[model samples]
Target: MLKKLLIANRGEIAVRVIRTAKALGYRTVAVYSEADANAMHTEIADEAVCIGPAQVAASYLNADVILEAARKTGADCIHPGYGFLSENADFSNACKEAGIVFVGPPASAIELMGSKRRSKIAMQKAGVPVVPGYEGDNASDDELIAAAAGIGYPLMIKASAGGGGRGMRLVEKESDLAENIKRARSESKQAFGDDELILERAVIEPRHVEIQIFADRHGNAVYLGERDCSIQRRHQKVVEEAPSPFVTPELRAAMGDAAVKAALACNYEGAGTVEFLVDKDRNFYFLEMNTRLQVEHPVTELITGQDLVSWQMTVAEGLPLPLAQNEIELNGHAIEVRLYAEDPSNGFTPQTGPLHIFKPAEGEGLRFDTGVRSGDEVTPHYDPMLAKVIAWGENRDEARRRLIRALEDTTVFGVTTNRYFLSRIIADSKFGAGEATTAFLQQEFSEDPSLQPAKLNIRQLALAAGVLAHGTVGEQAWSNAPATITPMKLDTGESTVELLVHNKDNVLSCRLGDQHHEIVLASIEKDTLCIIDNGIRQRCQYHRDGDSLYLQAFGESWSVTDLTHQPAAGANGAGSGRIQASMDGAIIDVLAEPGQTVRQGDTLVILEAMKMEHPVKADCDGVVSEILTKKGDQVKRKQLLVEITTN
Candidate 1:
């Protein structure tokens, strides 16, 4: 066994690796950037080392610095958790040359599977079903365009060297090919240091399922079922579950065998995942292979009751397969949802700030893997994912129910989150029927009325006002409060909520838009508010910062701002024709220049955040007057990017 293991990552993944390695009787070393001086992973490690600055290239991705940190800490091996250099074939080779064991597949295996073109050809040679496409090295734009013509319309252009849905474009028509191909090449170059791409026929609404495969140096490998990750937005996975509802026993066997073959074809060692795009007909085509532990590995652990990380450590120590294929058993249903500091209604824009309140849910068969605390600062330099909330049960429905409740039980404040968005998707009708597809957001929410934000009635507004005014002061404030509560208005999204409040003798009442309700606060304890209305008790947890109030209860989480002090209301694009960034990020492109004319809905500026690109488009025909930020400049939320004069 190794004497010590150095984790070459940060955030929750690093924390997870350290914990497992420590439990396996190995000293753990944590490496971090300057920005993560006081991060959770650093605080929990046996030894911590500062590698470089905040930028990934200077810090986590600096192979030389990371290897030095390992040597300084006397680490016998290095674990590259999920992202960063986890799949970098060069990094693995460096570790080998340095006499430091790398806890992953061989360098040759990584290089083979790292190339989408080469990997697909290898899989085809191994008799694994591969999607029909072109993987030729002649990837000139003209060559790709000709290849697309032969492949047919609506094909997928994917980066040959990267995953996580980055550098992928779905070209719907031949006319859209050039722009998408260029964008894919640029993003691919930035993300993976490679501009080469491969074209594949897009499988419409296929279930994005992947199998977990473990192998050792002794020519042994085993498959551990599969996970369904169909719930997505912008081609990024949000929710994943084990033992997919779509896959049956027979189908599981076939896909699992194919995944094992894909691994053996490269003499794979350590832990890796084989992804497949399974159509409705049960036919599965090989997707790419992830050459490290997955982000959603917990769901698989919950179902199989096995420690995959521990297995990885053992396998890397030159042990044979821990469990054969027949020894592994899928026991229960498990599901996981990624909780991010993002806004679902506002284009899923990533948010960054101090986490004022960071209470996570706790219960049976529920787990929360997080890296942030109440006072932690969510910086824009890293991914916006705050944590992953996962749940398990005896069956799929029970697991789904537990997951929804777990999300509702969570309370996060100070920044935007996708908590409510996650709840709504799990409760979606198509999801309830086990018919979820990649078009889940478009098909269900676009057609469902109830999925829209809930409008507050007079009663709810009265409660909200009372919480803001009398919060932390207890119910006794009602006695000294004004008899006729002040008339106030709050701004929530596009609606301006106006109401008049009346507080007298420990009771609160409100009137607005032909409605009225009286409420009495029973008590207050920290952030929990217990109130009584119409002889019914409702206990809700809330957080207050200035005029902003975030409340969660009764299966809903709402954020309301007290705009009573403001003199008037304003729409999102009202009056000022300034185009502002919707999130904190770097400028990826300046699509329109000053003095340039643009039509309505034309993209003017492109912002990159959390590895995704968001375009700032013109709302009306206008001429660009100024550009506030240029390409490669970092920006903050609501920061002005451009000025346009509408004609």
Candidate 2:
């Protein structure tokens, strides 16, 4: 068995590996960046080291420094948990050269399966069905464009070396070919350091399913099962389930067999996933292979009754396969929803701030995998995934209902999250029926009014704020008289919530829009409030930053404004209109000029953030008076980007 294992990663994954390593009697070493010195992983390890700064290139991806940390810690093995260097071929080779065990696949296997184009060709050669496309070596732009035409319209241009849809684009017509190709190449270069691309005939409304396969050094491998990852947004999975509801035994066997074949072809070892795009007709074609433990691995673990991380460790120590294909049994169904620090109401833009309240749901058959806690800040330097909530049950409907209940009961205040949105997806009739496709979000949930939070009076919030900003019956309580007193107004930017309030005899009554709710401060703790509303007590979690309060209640997180005492504002950009940066990000491209004419909906600027491109369009017809920021400039949220003299 390996003696000491150094984790070359961070967040929940590092913590996850550390727990398993410790339980298996192996000492663990944690590596962190400057920003994560006080992180949970660092705190939990037997030993810790600061690798570099918060920037990924300087820290997590810094292979040499990570190796040095291993050497200094006298670790016998380096476990590149999932991201960062988990699939980096060079890093694996370096670990081998340093006489350190790389707890993953062979460097040669990563090299073979790392690129989508190469992997597809290998699969094709191994008799696995693959989508027809162009993956020729050293192809020019014109060659790729020509190949796209050959592949026909409505094809996908994918980064030859990408996953998670970083460098993928769908071209519906010939007019979009050039621009899509250019953007794809640029994004590919930035994400994977390879500008090469592969073209594929788009599989319409396919069910995204992947088979989990594990191999050992002794030429033994077995496919565990398949996971349905069809629920997606921007081409990344949002919800994943084990023992796919849409897959029958016959289809599962075929997919599993093909996955085993692919593993064998690569001379694979350790844990890997072979993904496929299954059409409505049950015809599955080879998609890219992910050479690491997936984010949704818990669902598989729940259904299979196995600890995959342990298998990886045992295999890394030169052990044979843990079990044969016949020994493995899929016992139950499991579903997992990714909890992200993102605003679903807004284009799923990643949110950053302190998690004033990070409470994961608890019950039978529930597993919460998280990193951050209350008071921890959600930074822009890392992925926005806050946690993974997995629920297991005896059947698909049982699992689905359990997942829905858990998701709707969870609370994560301070940062805007997709928690509410995840619940909506799982509760939908189509999703519960296992009819979710790759286009599920775009087709059924995009801008769905039902997903938006129900609007409430800011005055009730102000009353809660009054208790939070001061305290119940404290030195800061609202003062000076007939306590059933004055009226106040709160502007939420979208609407002004008028309020008539007073606090007397422990009863607080506030009226809003022909409705009234009597509020009594039951209790108050730091970031938590217990309010008695009309003889019923309800507890809520909240964090106040100036006039904005991020609160959580009834499985939803929201940001409310308390403008009880601010000057009334004119319409946004009332006079000299300027299109401001919607969020803090880097300017990738500028389509408007200082003197350019623009219409109400023409793209004026493009910003790249959280690994996605957001086009900023003109809100009104105007002549651009000034362009404050240029391409490649880093911008702050709400900063003036393009000044326009509206007609």
Candidate 3:
């Protein structure tokens, strides 16, 4: 067994590996960046080291620094958890050269499977069915454009070295192919350092199911099970479940066999996942092989009753397969939802801030895998995934219901999240019937009103007013004088609402325009407000940050700003011409130059954040009067990037 193990990653994954490694009697070391100085992973490990700054390139991806930390800590094995350098061939080689065990596949296997182009060819030779298109070495712009003619319209240009939807684009017609290809290459180069791309005939409305395969050094391998990751946004999985509802035993066996064959063909070892796109007719084609433990591994663990991380360690120590194919049994159903610090109402933009209350629901058959707590900071230097909530049950419906209840009770107050959105997806009729496909979010759930952020209703506004005046109301609880009427103003994102509020004997009367509400405050404990709105008792969670308040009610989160005491209005050039950064990010591209004429909605700058690119477009047609920010500049949210004089 490995003596000392170091985790070359951060967040929930690093915390996950550390717990498992320690439980298996291996001394665990954690590596972190400046931004993670006080992260939970660093705090829990037996030993910790600061590798570099907040940026990933200078920290998590700095293999040399990570290796040096391992050497100093006397760690004999390094586990590159899911992201960062987990699948980097060169990093694996470097670990081997340093006489340290890389707890993953061999360098050769990684190199071969890392490239989608090469992997597709290798899979073809191995008799695994693959989506037909182009994976040739001729990757020049013109070559790709020419290949599109042969592949026909409605094809996917995918980054050869990409996963999680980065550097992937769908071209519906010939005219859009060239531009999408350029975008794919640029994004791929920034993400994977290799701009090589592969074209595949788009498999419309297919179910994305991946088989989990584990191999040992002694030429033994077995398939654990399959996971359905069909519901997606921007090509990334939003919800995942084990023992795919859409896959029958026959399809599962075939996919498992193919996944095992693909693993063996590349001489793979340790834990890996072979993904496939299964059409409506049950025809499955090779997608890509993720050469690391997936984020959704908990769902598999719940169904199979196995510790995959421990298995990875066992394989790293040259142990044979834990169990044969016949010994493995898929027992129960498990569902998982990714809890992200993102605004689902606003294009899923990543959110960063202090976590005022990061409490996940606790119950039977519920598991919360998280690395941050109430006081931990969510930074912009990494992915915004805060936690993974997995629920297990005896049947699929039980699991689904448990997941929905857990999601509703989960609280993440300070930062915006998709907590409600995840519940809505699982509760939807289409998803309940397991009919979701890769296009489910765009095709089915796009216009679902429940998926959008909840606007404050009259009851919620009354609750907010009562909560806002809780302290003062409590002080005047026994006062005999008539209740004082106070006028206040609140900005509810949609529009400003002026309200009249006063508390008498713990009952508050609030009037917004012509609407009047009588709310009785019952109790206030640790941010949970219990109030009776017109005789109906309600409990909701809220967090107040200065004048800005966030409330969690009605299975959705609402933001309100107390603008009562502030100045009312001012004329501004917000929508007329100024192009502002929508979020805090680094400028990766500047498309507009000063004095250039551009149309409204024309993209002027590209901002990269949280491993995704967002285009800052011109809000109005005009001549570009100034290019305030250039490429490589770090900008804050709402910072002016361009000044356009409207026509």
Candidate 4:
């Protein structure tokens, strides 16, 4: 076993790798950007190094800095975790040249699998089923149009070097092809530094099934079964599970065989994943291969009862195959939900704030991989993924139940997250019936604003009432003389709540409508309160800036403004305004400029943020007055990008 290893990444994945490295009696070194100087992963590592500023390119993606950190820390191996340079062939080669183990597949394998076009060609040559599309080098527009016609309508244009759903466009008609292709190319170049693209037939209602394959340098390889990752938003997976409910035993065996073949074709070694797109007819086609550990690898670990990180270390240490194909057995069912720092009610936009309270559920067969803690700030400069919660049970239903329970019990305050949305999804009737597809969120949940809380005041009231019942009001408590007891009334547009408080013996009792409850005072600070109610404690953090009370509960935050105090006239200014940039990003395209007359719902501009492109559309019929930002210009949130003059 290695004595020490350096993790060349950040966030939950870095923390995850550290835990396993420590379990194997290896000292861990964590590298951090300026923003992550006080992050949880850095605090947990045996030694930490500051690499560069907050920008990923200056820190996490800086190969020279990472290698220098490894050399300085005396680490024998460097674990890329899952993102950053995990699959960068050059980074792998650099580690090898520096005489440090990369703890992943060989550089050649990464190079072959990292490019989608090249991977498709290799899979096709190896006799593996591939999607019908064009992977040729011709970039002519006419050639692409011909390829699309041959592949039929409703094809997908994807970046050849894309991952995490960036640089992909779905074209259902020929008329929409040119613009989408241009957008995809621009986004692909901006995201991956590669503008190369490939077109493929869009598989309708497909289930994403991926096989985890491990190989030793000695020409031995084995597949650890399959994981179903059909629950997604914008082509990015949100929930994943091992031993898919839809995959039959025979189909699993066949996919496993094909995955092994793909690995052997590249002389692959260490850990890698072969992803496939399974259509409604159960026909599977090779999608691509990930040449490093995946974000959802916990599900596979749960079912196999194997520590994949340890295995990676062993393989890097030149150990031969320890388990044969026949010796591996599919155990129980396991499911994982990725908790992101995003607001589901707002098109799942990314959110940033301090994590005032962070708590993870604990129980049998429950696992949590996290990177942040209480008081840590989640910045917008990195991926919004907060943590991965995994649950294992005897079967799929039991596993789903456990996962839902775990998600409900897990609490995060100070920023918005998708905890409630995830709970709703896992408990949905269709999801429970095993009828999920890649379009699950878009078709059933995305457009339905009613599925999410229109107002979080009810939950906020519950938490606040719980806090007031706990007598933490300090010197503001009512005097022995009959003092004027002020009743707190909260309105949420749909409902109203009034709380009556009585305090004695450092304890508080409150009447909430027809129910009476008691609580113990924990602490009370400026603008926030913490309390214990009926032996179950919950922390309620709120800010009373003037008449507005911002309440955050269970990772979903909302503001309750006092309607009694009306806003000053003309506070918002002007009669009509053009839709502005909602967040900091690069302007990918200007679909409409000055003097262009457009109607409501007409696309005006495309803004790319966090590697995803968002289309900003006209809200009303108007003629464009000005276009302030051009394509490739970086913009800030609420910056004026366009102006319109209504007729």
Candidate 5:
């Protein structure tokens, strides 16, 4: 049943494993990474290769260039579609020493659940309810602060070979546990060269849930129940669902029989998952085990009509276990979300460029697993997750009202996403009463920035002031035409705005303060502009440059300029350059060196990017005259890294 396969991994889970490996008739292949040469899963695979130079250690964690692009695309099975080299147990023992077929699991079960301290000591010797922490192997920082005061003070030090939330931390005092255990062992030795750690007990208001175990090659496993994922932020996940508006049905049959006894205590096969955490009294624990395939597995494939990449290619062809555990019937509520170019009012950051209007969100229980379209290019090299947006219904309040109408009928445009912060956390009310957690976006919308929504819309500022006061020469630019007024300048605080135009029968009547409306233009060419009203069309995007216009929408972006050509204000809100590097990272530590004097919010340089870190401070009183990128170089976006001299 496995005629071809190969994926290895790129965006949107390699276009969701080439649509179920072409609906199970297999033949896929893909691979990519010359910054995804023309991406979209390298133009819908069926065979494609390139494998290197876009740095994921020379392309998606190399592994001998993905086993020579699956032995030069003859494939026969590879599919590691979760993060690079998906759960690499030496890339599944180098695709079983090159005889290929590593659809997932078994590199001795990804080296016993890819080591989070040996999957919490094999889910506490498979009785399954683990998480009281301290996976001993003592690394002495006062013996991990007396094992985080014997696993108590809001603990969690994690990183015994961490995953996405990289090398964790959370202390909460014992005098900040020896500088957060030396910054989680220097970010777990710079992200998993394993600086070894483990302390646990941080659960307050947690939720994560998981379970999706599948196995085969004879040891048959089953469970595909839970999924919640508590809409997290720093600890990663951004919305995910599937049967969990706070799990039940007897806690989904006891976390699906403790996630199939933690995947038969690692004799696991094909797709994996397990995870857990729970807590608001429904109790649950064991939080590790994700050997592969999950970036919210399409909300467990829209509540289990199942297609987990065609059940990981029918359990890697060794097939068996084709649904049992009460024939797994979970048919309703789904959800998903995770669009992410990032920038939920800043601190979510990431955001790169070109996706100029990429639509998404279609009907019948919407899906969209996407890998970027409409002119692609969202580079900073990877994982800015350009698409997931699931939905499905029949329950959980119709899957949170169809995922807030599929995040307001999504419509990305050049970067900056979070699609209105996932439609304000699915029109939150403690996430519509199921009361989410992972600190639910820092406990109900971090200090309220008007609880999120409003990414501008007064019908998109009256269709960008009726396309700059009707300049499409519609009804002959309003007959007598003398009415070509402009005055725009309103960057969210609205200081100016006067636009007024008139184009009769061909309709375009505008006016911006006394309200008049009736735009309906729907397409203007050269930098595009689509308008419409009442039937709601709004698609304004323009770049122009010489007279400055910018505009963009739904992925928020703005700029207007043309203040009658001029520059006047400058009372120290400074912006001419120097103090650069706002992304494209790697510097990780400088803290002012050159002449070093520093003051006003000092920190000076840290950088890192994408896999997180960030610092770079000193914006007022300073001296350090020029550090200009050092600790590990790489630099780029706005590229300066340090210069300071406020003399």
Candidate 6:
């Protein structure tokens, strides 16, 4: 039996495993990078060790270093949480050689199921229906192009050794195949260290359903319902729910049996997920098998009433199945959304900064799993996902509504986030109707008005003016004097507005561009502001840092800047001939140099951050005047990379 557990990952997953391991009477050790010195996981573990630098290759993915940390901490077992080296077969073998139990399946199973090409071939032999595609060993661009001819257009190119949308692309025409293949290969090599590509026929409008299966050392396996992860952006899951609304009782059993067969094919043990694409007619085909716990496991846990981490421990100790397949039961419905530090309006580009205020709403049936707290810095060295918000109810609509409310009430300031975007998705008509498929985001909700950042209205402007005026203790000395008119100028990124405020008798009268209003400040405590806006009692949450303020109200969030004291004189706007870095990242490629002629929309530089690539392009036809960055240099957001003299 294991007495000490070491987590071989970071962020929320590491914290999650440490909590469960401590409750089971085992001492837990946490391994972190130098960048994560003050991270939440390190603070909660019984013992903490710094493995290496912030780059994953130097830390989390460094199997040798992680093993050494476990040995130094006297940990007898290691839990490879999903991501970094979770599906690495060599890491599993190394733990066995070191005489430490790895809380996952055997090395042989991981090796077989880790490759999408190999797994699809294995599933075909195991009598499981597989997607029609090419899974050959030859991954050359020429070979893949030839295979695309046979598979036809509108097929998918996937990285053989990767998942989670990395190294994946949808090819719609013959003309677009080669470029997409090149991009797919490049992304695959960067993300998984494998440039192998596979071709598959795209399943149109299919529901992304996956079965959760668990096995023990003994010959027993059972499936725990299913999770519908059809709602996605860029093939990354945005929302996931348990007991899919599209799955019937009969269909669920069939998919579950197939998942168990796939698990038993490689002599699998521990937690695994088998994903499938189910057509409108209910025909399901194998997609891929995830050989570790999934990010959306909370939904399954809420429905099945089981702690999967505890089961992993029991199975690692060579136990039998906890319950028979027939005895397993699922109840209620649960939905979850991934809260990320990103700007949805700007193509969901990742954002990084200090988290001045991070608070999850508290309520029954609500579960928040997070890794950071107030004042934590969101760096570009790791994934931008901040937390997971899950809600459970007796039915689907109830769960959806509860999730919507939770996302709206949750507060995250300092950096831009997708809190409001997530609320809009959950409240969308198609999502509320339980009719969303994989094409929901692209085909149906592509033009959603809520995708843009909220515009500052007069009401919110009045409230901001009132908040700015309320805290002035010295200014109140002029109560006996006539009404004092204070001028304020605020910028909301999208636009700017100026207003005049007069404070008298706890009422703030404000004027903006010939419009007048009165806002009564009912009360103010900490960050919460309770006010009566035009006879309507409402509340808003805010965080102030000097002249900058972040506010959340009316189901939207806004960042207001005080520009009253700053003088501005320039016609320079977005197309100012200056290309700036969108976020802090490493410069992978510099496409332009001094004296180079460029056209509008030409790629100037490419930056890699949060495990993805972002290209900075020219905004107008021009000649490059200066290039400030080079390959391999780290840069900050809004830092100038290239300057061009426009025509």
TM-score of each: 0.88, 0.85, 0.89, 0.80, 0.33, 0.91
lDDT of 1 by residue, 322-357 (tens): 899999999989999999988776666788767889
Top candidate (lDDT): 6
Candidate 2 TM-score over all chains jointly: 0.85
TM-score of candidate 1 against the unseen true structure? 0.88
Q: Rank the candidates by lDDT, best first.
A: 6, 3, 1, 2, 4, 5
Model 6 misplaced regions, further than 4 Å: 139-153, 173-183, 472-481, 514-517, 567-583, 587-608, 612-647
TM-score of 4: 0.80
The RMSD of every model to the true structure, in order and in angstroms, is 4.3, 4.7, 4.3, 6.6, 22.9, 3.6
- Give the clashing residue pairs of candidate 3, or none: none
Clashing pairs in model 1, backbone N/Cα/C closer than 3 A: none
Question: Per-residue lDDT for 499 in model 6?
Answer: 90
After superposing candidate 1 on the true structure, give the runs of residues whose Cα lies further than 4 Å from its correct spot.
Answer: 145-150, 172-183, 447-459, 471-477, 480-482, 489-498, 513-515, 563-647
Arrange candidates by TM-score, highest first: which order?
Answer: 6, 3, 1, 2, 4, 5
Model 5 bad stretches (over 4 Å): 1-115, 118-161, 165-186, 189-194, 197-258, 263-328, 332-335, 339-390, 393-405, 408-415, 420-481, 485-647
Total clashes for model 2: 0
Task: Report the C-alpha lDDT of model 3 over 57-94, residue by residue, as the tens digit.
Answer: 89999999999999999999999999899999999999
Candidate 5 residue 624 C-alpha distance from true site, Å: 12
For candidate 5, lDDT tens digit of each residue in 1-647? Answer: 56988887887788878987888677888888787888888888877899878878887888897788788777877888887778878778778888888888888788777778877887888888887868877477887787677677878787887876877878787888888888888988887677888788888777888888888879878888888888787888888888788777998898888888888877888788888888889889888888887888888877878788788778888878678778888888888888888776667778665666677767778888888888776767677878888888888888788777777766665566777777777887888888778887886688655334334445555555555554542333333344444445443322334445455443666566666667666556665577666787767656443443556555445544344324433111233214776656678688668877877666778877676687867666767777767787877655666666575
Q: Model 6: per-residue lDDT, tens digit, 50-168? A: 99999998999999999999999999999999988889999999999999999999999999988999999999999999889899895678888888899997999999988879999
User: 49, model 2: CA deviation in Å?
Assistant: 0.8
Best-performing candidate as measured by TM-score: 6
Q: Which residue runs does candidate 2 get wrong by more than 4 Å? A: 145-150, 450-470, 473-483, 489-496, 502-507, 513-515, 518-538, 543-548, 561-647
Q: Each prediction's Cα lDDT score?
A: 0.85, 0.83, 0.88, 0.81, 0.74, 0.89
lDDT of 2 by residue, 82-183 (tens): 889999999999999999999999999999898888888899999999998899885778998888878897899999888888899998998998999899
